[model samples]
Target chain A: MTGERTVGERTIGEQVVGEQVAGGGSGTDDFYGRLRAYEGRAAVAGGEGRDAVNEPMIRHWCEAMGDTNPAYPASAPPTMLQVWTMGGLSGHTGGSIRSEAYDELLALLDGAGCTSVVATDCEQEYLRPLRPGDRVTFDAVIESVSPRKTTKLGSGHFVTTRMDIRAGGELVGKHRFRILKYAPARRSSAAKERTTEVKEARRPRPVINRDNAGFWAGVAEHRLLIQRCTDCGTLRFPWLPGCGACGCLEWETVEASGAGTVFSYVVMHHPPFPAFDPPYAVGLIELAEGVRMISNITGVPYDKVRIGMPVELEFLRVDADLELPVFRGAVA
Target chain B: MTVRVGDELPPLRIPITRTLIVSGAIASRDYQDVHHDAEAAKEKGSPDIFMNILTTNGLVGRYITDHFGPHVRLQKVAIRLGAPNYPGDEMVLTGQVTAVTDGTAEVSVTGRNGIGNHVMGKVTLRLSLDFPHGEADSPQRGAR
Candidate 1:
């Protein structure tokens, strides 16, 4: 009860404030020591940003995530999009955060008396589309920090970071992430406390039948190609084995004009994918060939992409040999 | 008989479910726990949700495209998401045929979540309309 104490007699707040005010009282700055320790102990996690949109990675990311939307015409086995975007697609792939960084961050939070940490929200805005064959530099910066209160978990701090993804001297995407950390709640003496581990769920490989073999193959080559049914002459995308309308098995592989108009779109304030930062727009675009492609609309402010707006395609590499196709409003 | 301007287009019922949600997520490469994990979602801040807006839009667009047939090209679709759509919620995609010309038609579309409008927007179609009007069918050869 002497200084700022939350848990019984262990006063971390008092210690922190005391150290800050005392200046030179404590033996060697524990803040720096603690920071170094955290750097060594925190969990390392990262998100992937494309220098230029790589179509193969976009398709692979979707495939890994088991996306079956007809808009993405990639050919590949479904993996996990969240993991891929979170810089987890490869054990040690490109543009991923070192796990040591997570360990360090956790250590820092723990020293601050925060025991439980979880990713709460994410938002990303694309300035330019990511493409294949472009070497991109990933820059992650802590944007803001705030303390929050939760009924179930007492009190904690929220850390937000703005990740600026750049490729070829152009800003490709701006990723914003919010992480929540809480102090283990101190309950009544008589009540037994319940604690559980927050685990990242595992995803299984998507079952790829003959329906989408060609699409996946094109992804390996960083291509955004679709199938035009030889029978009905209808251009169908997201690669089904046969035509959706005519049920024709025979088809010709055609490249997308990659040009479309935004039919409509909605800005997502919530994180729908574990790998994604939130505040994005899921858009429906009617391609030049009369096919519709569903993708995340990037490069413009979420509120600015309007109905009947022109857009162009950009490829993203989800991982090696895998690509994803996303879209942006075509600038007039 | 042609649909009158402002006449309500026939309401199309779309089954909102988890599978569709997953499909849309996969297509857009947005696989978050809140979308696929029921328990994880409850832990976050959801009431056992169903589909994300991307999937919802996909369904709505599919409904119109299916109705319009292959020849009529879909020119545009503009929509907005209002309420959270849970699985099993009957999504009644309703619209009004706002405009129809000799070679095209425009429809205002909306997805209702029973309680209220979940998604609202518009769609435009450019029709070949069999053949171009007032133009001769034969290609004119260069004058000798």
Candidate 2:
């Protein structure tokens, strides 16, 4: 709570509890340790639907859902599988089908301070439609427990449960439900004021060793350099010490023409990463000297980067000490 | 990911929320107004914002890998959307193995929401190390 300050929704406090958790690392293992025990076990068993599918109830449900479709016959909506068993507005607080294990599980999570819960999603498959006045029976089992996930509300675990619904003792539908049980995160009051002192995220350091040092040194000088096998005239874009074709350790550097054409390209769009902007183009550029290398493509819309598009090499200053060779689209 | 006929992956349940639908749509780079804007969605014939296909695709990938571990790579996910998954609905995903080769498996998958089948599809998974040998050496199919 030290140095905590708050003005609005924003806040700045002390250092983050564990930054690794934000990066999806296993920093909150204890929270999940108590969760994994219930996986694949029966959460509720021998559950019987309170009411069989009937006409008046169907009309009520259809009216509530604003559904006006008429098919002459009465078939309950597949989504209504759970509706038949729900305690409804009054809520079914306790019952035989409600497993002690389920109660204990909620207690365990509550004990860990994750008292709030919100349903995240569900999936259902229907094998048969419910006719008027068909009794529904069901059973449910704990399916899986995900590790701690950071959501807007806070950090918590997602628990999934699966239910099998049957009509007249015949399998009809399967329902899977997931919920995030979490405690609301306490925002740091000092967070807004401390943001100015925050540094830029450091780029992942390149693995530089004796074999690749000189190539980076050349990049530092804004030169596009390629390695050539002295013995066989073989050229490679990636600066490898030895030639694969001739088994020669002796190699020399050659200054490239800094011109190339796109051989193949990919427009990344999903799963935004920290270090790079998505929907950007990355191209495998085949150089004029005939070796291909991958680099960031610039000066063209990510969608418009075509095969055989011309490009010219340019140096991009990535940070304080790192420079990278990037290719810019040449004017048509 | 290696599979034969009749293999079943464990079920995965998901509870739909405004945040889950919105974040999943964003992660998949889907910027449709209906996916994130509730008011816009209501105007466009939906009672509320619903989950998009890309989020369903990503969740399918998660379900497949969760069953097969991290080594199995999903090569293709072809799904057709059915009923919309509105917020406050629960989705259950189930899968059955249809075919298998040395290092690959093809699975038939279905994700069902409260209303009905949200997405039905076939997934092709390639297990990188299922065997020592890689895929077929030659592109040509030699006729007997």
Query: Estimated TM-score per prediction?
Result: 0.34, 0.37
Fnat by candidate, in order: 0.00, 0.00
Compute the lDDT for candidate 2: 0.68
Please give the C-alpha DockQ score of model 1: 0.01
Q: Which 10 consecutive residues of model 2 chain A have the lowest summed lDDT?
A: A4-13
Candidate 2 lDDT over residue span A71-188, tens digit each: 3127664445556666543444454476777777888878877776645544555566677888888889988877666655466666878888898889987766666677656556
True-contact fraction for model 2? 0.00
Q: Give the TM-score between model 1's chain B and the true chain B.
A: 0.78
Listed per candidate, the RMSD to the true structure in angstroms reads: 30.6, 28.1
Q: How many clashing pairs per prediction, in order? A: 52, 22
Per-residue C-alpha lDDT of model 1 across residues A127-207, encoded as one tens digit per residue: 433444555555565544453344233355556555555556666555555565766455553122111111232222335
In order, what lDDT does every prediction score? 0.55, 0.68
